[model samples]
Target: MIYVEGGSFDMGYQRGRDGADNDDVKNAKPLHKVTLHSFYIGKFQVTQEQYYAVMDKDSNSHFKGDRLPVETISWEEAKVFIERINQKTGKKFRLPTEAE
Candidate 1:
């Protein structure tokens, strides 16, 4: 895990010809500032092998490599895996929120 120093920043971009082209960027809206608190985050995306170690199940990725990020898991499965890992490590482990 990496420790992130907290700070405040504007969350959205200005709307104009010079702004982001994608419509999805509009979801950021109102150009408001947000404050964050110090928190720990994974240094890298979780790997297939790491997921397998925690969950004791194959990641089932077609790529099939230890270094590759695990993908295509349902939310419920991920929650269960996180719970199991928390139990084993005796520490809280959770997915990052969008604002983080």
Candidate 2:
């Protein structure tokens, strides 16, 4: 895990920029600031092996490899996995929010 010292930063794009016609950018108008609290995040993505160790079941990832990142899981499944792993390890773990 890596410790991230949190701070505030400007988020979203400015109103005028070349090639900003896309809807995604349009929705991001009116620059805003976001503040975040310090937190720890995994240095690497969750691997199949780690998921298997925690969940006690095959992840059924499209590409089969112990070191590869786990995929094809829904948000609910990930929450359940985190809950179970927290129970096993006595550590609080959760998914990061979009701003995070």
TM-score, every prediction: 0.80, 0.85
Span of ten consecutive residues with least summed lDDT in model 2? 15-24
Top-lDDT candidate index: 2
Candidate 2: misplaced stretches above 4 Å? 26-29
Task: Candidate 1: give the clashing pairs.
Answer: none
Model 1: per-residue Cα lDDT over 10-89, one tens digit each: 77666773366677775656677989999999999889999999988987877779989888788888888889999999
lDDT at 65, model 1: 92
Candidate 2 residue lDDT tens string, 2-97: 999999988778756435568778666467899999999999989999999989998889999999999888899899999998999898999998
User: lDDT (CA) for every model shown?
Assistant: 0.84, 0.88
